[model samples]
Structure formats: structure tokens, C-alpha cells
Target: MKKTKKLFGALTLTLLLGLIVGCGSSGEDKNSADSSNKGTTDIQKIKDAGVIKVGVKEDVPNFGYMNPDTNKNEGMEPDIARLIAKELTGSEDNVEFVGVTAKTRGPLLDNGELDMVIATFTITDERKETYNFTTPYYKDEVGFLVRKADKLTDTASLDGKTIGVVQSATTKEAIEKQAKELGVSFKYQELGSYPELKTALTSKRIDAFSVDKSILTGYVDDSTEILKDGFSPQEYGIATKKANTELNDKLNKSIEQWEKDGTLEKIYKKWNLD
Candidate 1:
């Protein structure tokens, strides 16, 4: 009878020990999974990959453009991307530039196809909620590039005219608000790119190719001229995924340093943007 009692006690003790061991093993596995699957930070992930992918406009000359001759992106924004790459991976060549339009940059960033977007992204309160933007590296205002023959001498002349703006760009809003205040109105046509808007203007489809003045500067030819009037001061900033605070902070630091040291001015001058 004592033997029976001893065996039963042993069996109970073993079961309790097994339960404790199983629980401990389960906890260890859960911790290991969390460490392995969710451990890397956004910037750390870029560092681990040894490259930083950036979205840039391939058509907006001087801001971000694809140079047909060299088949490389060359512009103020691409130069800025190079600087960021230097800051991140210790070499400017460690950066890759993917062409993106206003409508596409956000999705590319969201889908993790790009690490950051330096594609003349404007900073606004609404956009701030969806992505992290650094302090404004450049400021510009919306303007109109109309054919000289159209004689669009001022904003008032834009009444009853069709203005072309890039899709997902803020220029349309700027124009509408200003036009309303000025007691004038116009029609709007949205295009996929700056070049498309320019072509539309050249082909007489859109009366004016309207965008930021600096961008307008890129499309002006003998037939086209920018109106003296401008509106909606746009503050351009580098944008990263909403969850990438580390990269955003790092970029802001770089922009601040550049602003202080005139590096940004140098880049602007290099691209004839100043």
C-alpha cells in the first residue's frame, strides 16, 4: 500500500514537471519568433541590404529627370538623393532611383518598393498622417506655363480656359482656391506626368501647363512663358514610410546641416534651379 502511494505521488510530480517544461518551451518559442520576425527597423533594414531605394520623378527636369544621353537620373532631387545615400550607406552609388509620379510615389512607398521618396513631395498636414516628411528642403509656388500666343498674361485671363495639372499634385487645389478668391474660374485636366502636361499644352489640348514655377521653368520654350502670378507656396520635403521615424529623423538632420552650410544652395545652382 505504501509502494502504491509512492508511485502515485511520483506520477503526479512528473506530470506537474512536464506541464512546467511545456509552458517554458512554449514561451521560449514565442519570444524567439518575435525576435526573428519583427526585430529589424526600417533604417536597419536598409543598412542590412546595403542600399537605399529612392523614388524620384523621371520627367521633371532640374528637379528630377532622366537624362536620355547618359541614361541616369540628373537633377536637384537626385543630387539630394545621392547625399542621402551618402549619409546612409557611406557611398552615393549605394542608392537606386525608381521613377515615380505624384500618383505613384505614395503607393510605392507604402508597398515597400522604395525606402523613401524624394520626388518633390509636398508637405501638408493631411499627408503628414500617412507618411513622415522632413523639414522643407525647398520652397516653390504654383505657376502657369502657357503659350505666348494664348496671351494668358495674368490669372484673370485663365477664365474659361483649360489648365493641365499633374495627377495627385496639389496645383489643382491651389489654382481652384486662388481662382475662386480672384472671382475667376477655369476647367482642369489631370495628366499622368509633367511631360504629358507639357505635350498637352504644346498640342493645344490644355491651354496651360500649370505646376510649381520651378517646374514650369523646365518646360518653358520659345512658344511658352510662365505667368508672373503664382500661388500656393509649396514646401518640398523628403518623405518616408509612416513607420520610418528613424530614417525621417536622420534625413531631417542632414537637411538642417545642409541648409546651414549652403549645401542645398549648391545643389540648386548645379541644376540651374537657383
Candidate 2:
């Protein structure tokens, strides 16, 4: 009887010890997996890809434009994109620039088709929920490009007039708010590109083409003039996927460094944007 009792006790102790060791090993394995996952961050992925995909405007000159002569994207934003590529991949040539408009840039970033957008993306509190935006690299204000014959001087002259704005842009909202404040109303024509808006203005299809003053500079000709009235001071920032906060932080740091060291100022001057 004593031997039987001793054997049963030993067996029970062995089983308990085995269970404790198995549970400890399982926990350690889980922790190891979690630690290994840290290597798969967004920045790490960008580094491994050897190229950083950037979305930029191919229409807005001086900010971003596809130069017909050189068949290359040349402007302030593309230059900034190259700098970012150099920082990430150790070569400015490692960047792939995808042309993006206001309507498409968001979708491209959401679908993982582009890593970042350096277009003239205006930062708003509502948009911040969907994407992370870096600190402002440029500041501008909304203005109107109208035919010199219109004799329009300010918002008050635009009552019941049609204003052309880019599709999916904030210009309409800014204009609408301003209209209400001044008790003036205006019709709006939404277009896909700045050139289209300029064409509409030239054709008398719209009374005015409205966008950032800097962008309007590219479209203005002898027949057109930018109104002295400017509103809605816009802050342009680089946007990234909402989940890619690490990449956004890296970009913000780079922008800060550029600003402090006058690198951004030099680029702006190179493009004659400053």
C-alpha cells in the first residue's frame, strides 16, 4: 500500500511540473513572436523596397509640373520628394513620382499605391482623421483668376457669378464660407485640373478660376488677373497613410531640419517660388 501511494504521488507531481513548464514555454514563444514583429514597421518596409513612391501634382507649375522640354517632373514638390528619397534610400534617383490630383491622392494613399503625397495637400482637422500630415512646408491663400475684362476687384463683385474650383479641393468650402459672411452668393463649377479651370475661364464658361494664389500664378496670362482679394490661408503638408505614423514622423523631422538649415528655402528659390 505504501509503495502504491508513493508511486501515485510521484506521478501527479510529474504531471503538474510538466504542465507548468509547457505553459512557461508557450508564453515565451508568444513574447518572442511579438518581439520579432517589431522589425516589420512601415519605415523598415520602405527601406527594404529600395524605392519610395511619392504622389505629386504634374499640373501645378513651380509647385509640381511635368516639364515638356525635359520630360521630367521639375518643381518645388518634386525636389522635396527627391530629398526625401535620398534620406530613405541614400539616392534621390530612387524616387518614383506618381501624378496625383486632389481627387486621386487620397485613394492612392489608402490603397497602398503610394507611400506619401507631397502635392499641394491642404491640411484640415477633418482630413487628419484619415491620414497623417506633416508640418506645413508652404503657406498660401485662396484667390481668384478672372479675365481682366470682368472688372471684378473683390468678393463683393462675385455675387451670383460662377466660380471654378478644382474637384475635391477645399477652395469651394472656403469660398462658400466667405460668401455667407459677406452676404454674397456665387455659383460654382468644379473641374478636374487647373488647366481645365483656366480653359473654362478663357472660354467664358466660368467667371473666375479659384485656387491658391501661388497655383493661380502658373495659370495667369495677359488676359487674366489674380484678384487682390485673398482668403483662407492654406497650409500645405505632406500626407501619409494614417497607420504609417512612423513614416510621417520621419518626414516631419526631415522638414524641420530643412527649415532650420535653409534647405527648403533654397529649393523654393531654385524653383523661383520664394
Candidate 3:
């Protein structure tokens, strides 16, 4: 009888131990799944890290540029990036700015070197296939900045002229398309950076510098004049990796809120874009 009792007790203890071990295994698996899911989302990761790294232009004044006196990025694009960081992290200071040129920004973002890009990135059907972009924050037109001495009055006058443009930008294509429509021919010189192109224009190495009018405005002075009529209407947007639906939705919401509250208008006015 005692042997029977002992056998029953052992069986009960074994069953209890088995149940405990099974429950523990199930709990561990659930935790592991949760962690894996959390890591897959950029918004959650950014929230966990408490900072967002943004790519921005360093030479295009009034859009994104490094102020010499402050030695910090200051411009409409930077301001908009800060606003995004603020929306995500509850503080504008939670952002780290990475200087990116037209030639580098796309690759940097593609390789996960940047969390987002706000470098006056113009949205196009081709780019949309590679990345997600928020609604247009700013609208722009492509224009030409020529030495006032050149006396070039319109796009047609750029025939046979050498024009400087930043590589990897849509500027060259836009210019060529416009020239084709106008039945003119021009030579293109691709530079690695905006400052280099601006220098080329100033030094007479290129007869004209071509880009978005807002950007050209920053470099214009007594020596240069922007063509009155511009082409290639552009809509600039903040960009992230393709199919980042959650981040895209959040950014779009933030942009909508800003637009409704006149925050966007204020920023435009601050940059003299109004």
C-alpha cells in the first residue's frame, strides 16, 4: 500500500514539473516573438533610441545649409527635420543632422545610414519606386542662374552654353528636357557638390548654374540673374525607405498638422520663401 502511495505521489510530482517547464517554454517563445516584432519597426526603434538621424543638404542655403557663424545647420529643410524629430521624440533636439549632397543622399538613405532625408528631395515616379516620400512640403521650379554679363534672357538663350549642375540630381534631365522642348542645345558639366557648381558659375567656368529656383536664389547676387521663366515644377518631400508605411503615415500626419496650424507657412516666411 505504501509503495502504491509513493508511486502515485511521484507521478503527480512529474506531471506538475512537466507543466511548469512547458509554461516556461511558451512564455520565452512569446517574449522572443515580441522582441523580434519590435525590432522590425523603425518607429519603435527610433522611440527606443530616442534619436533620429536625418540627411540634409549642407550647401543649399535657405533650404539646408551650414551657417558659418553658428557652425550648425540652419534653413527651411533643417527646421522641418527638427519638427519631425519633435513629433517623434517630443523634442526637436533629439535629431542628428548628417550633411548629404545630391550625389550621396540616396545611397546613404538606401544603406540605412540615415533614418530620413529632408534635403530638398524632389518626389518623382522613379524615386517613388525606391523610397517612400511624404506629401509635398514645398513646391519649386527649375531655373537658371547666369552671369548678368552674359545677358541671357531665357531658356532658349542657353543654347550652346555650358551649364553646371550637381550630379545625381534631376536638374540635368530637367534642363535637357526643357532645352529639347525649346529646340536648343547646351553642354552640361556635372559637379559633385552645389558649392562646386556655384563656384563654377562664379568663375565663368560654366555659363549658367541650373537647379531649383529656391536654391539658386541663395547664390544669386549682383553678378547673377535667374531666368524669369522656369520649368519642371517640383514638389519636395521627406523621404524614407520604401514601404515604411508606419513612418510614412506618421510623417504625413505631422505635415498635415503643421499645414493646418500655419506652421508650414511660418517656416516659409522665415526662409523668405513666402
Candidate 4:
């Protein structure tokens, strides 16, 4: 009887110990996984793959888009991304354009789907936490794009006009804050792409498109398009996930060199933009 009781007690103790050890192992494994991914980024991956995936909007002409006539991706954003790849890997043939919307750009970068994002992304205080941003490559104001036949920006001007914006963009958030403080409400027509936004504005499905004025200058300024200034000085930068400090540092240095050597302005002229 004494031996039976001792054996039972030992068995119970062994099971408890085993479970404790199992839990500890699991916790360690989880932390290991988390730490491994913490500093991992696509910068080196892009170098290894011999191609850089750049998130850009295909609908934002000049800054980023596909020329239907040539069936080729060409724009200032593509130009900058290609230049970055060339500087990093010593080849301009490493560009892979990936379409990204205002919202998807951040998440895609975070997940390593893109090596960098040059999709007319503006720098703001809120965005700094999730991504490393390059020096401001371009600066412009915010504006509204209305149809040629519309009176949205006529005498009264966008004082009471409905503004269209993508749901998760900095532009959307900025305008929301402005509308709230001014005690005004704007009719929201959230669209998926820049092309859709353009089509919506042209068809009067939405009153106007609200975004960085740089895009406006690239798309509307030269065309038979009408734009009205809604806000001022939105700043744009090349972005990488915050884990990619090395790439960001290199890019800033390159941008400075480009500016000093007049290459940056030459790129700007190629796109006919500010």
C-alpha cells in the first residue's frame, strides 16, 4: 500500500512538471518568432531578388501610372524607385512596380510585400511611427478637383462642397480633422483608386477629389482640369518600414546628392511637376 501511494504521487508530480516545461518551451518559441521578425525587412530581400517592389498608384499620372499607349509603367515615382534600386544594387533594371492605394501602402510595407513606397505618400507626425521616411522630396498644397462644368469652387467655393477621399489616407484624416474643428461636415465618397476618384469627380458622382496638390499639378495642371486650393503644403517622402533604417539613410544621402547635382530637378522636369 505504501509503495502504491508513493508511485501515484510521483506520477502526478511528473505530469505537472512536464506541463510546466511544455508551457515554458512554447513561450520561448513565440518570443523567438517575434524577435526574428522584428528587424527583418525587404531591403536585403530586394537586393537578393535583384528587383525592388515599389508601391505606387497606377492611376496617378506623372507621379505614377501606366501609359496605356506604351503599356509601360513610367512616372516620377517609378523614376525615383528605379534610381534607388540602381544606387543600391547598381542596376536600373530592378524595378517592379506594385500598385498600392493610400491605405494599403503602410500595411504592405509592414508585411514586407514592398521594398519601399514612393506612391505620393505624404509625411505626417502620425505616419512616422510605422515607417522610416526620407527627407521631403517634394512639397505641395492640398486641393480639390472639380469638373470643368461644375460650380463647386465658383463664388462660394468648397465652403459647403462634398469632398471625396480614400478611407484610410492621410489626406482623408487631415480633411476630417479640418472639417471637425471648423464645425463642418463633408459628404464622403471613399473610392479605391486614383482613377476611380478621377472618374467620380468628372462624372459628378462625387463633388471633388481631395488630395496632395502635387498629384493635382501632375495630373490636372497641364490638362484641361480645374483644381482649387483646399489646404497648403503637404510634404511627400520616400518611405520604408521603420525596420529599414539602413535603406532610409542611404536613400536620403542619394536624394541629397541628386539635389546637389541637379538630378532631382531633372527628374521633376521629366514629370513636369513641382
lDDT of 2 by residue, 1-274 (tens): 9999999999999999999999999999999999998778988898899999999999998999999999999899999999999999999999999999999999999999999999999999999999999999999999999999989889889899999999999999999999999999999999999999999999999999999999999988999999999999999999999989899999999999999999999998887775
**Best-fitting candidate, measured by TM-score?**
1
Off by over 4 Å in 2: 1-36
List, residue by residue over 31-119, the lDDT tens digit for candidate 3: 99999897778797888889999999989888999999999999999999898888888899999999998878999999988999999
Cα lDDT computed for each candidate against the true fold: 0.92, 0.94, 0.91, 0.78
Where in model 1 is the C-alpha error above 4 Å?
A: 1-20, 33-39
Candidates, ranked, lDDT: 2, 1, 3, 4
Worst 10 residues of 2 by lDDT: 265-274
Task: Write candidate 1's Cα lDDT for 114-148 as tens digits.
Answer: 99999989999999999999999999999999999
Model 4, range 50-136, lDDT digits (tens) per residue?
888889878777888888999878888888888888976779877888888887888898898888899888888878987899998
* Pairs in steric clash, model 4: none
The whole-model C-alpha lDDT of candidate 1 against the native structure comes to 0.92
Best by lDDT: 2
Per-candidate TM equals 0.91, 0.88, 0.87, 0.77
Candidate 1 lDDT at 266 equals 93
Candidate 3: what lDDT?
0.91
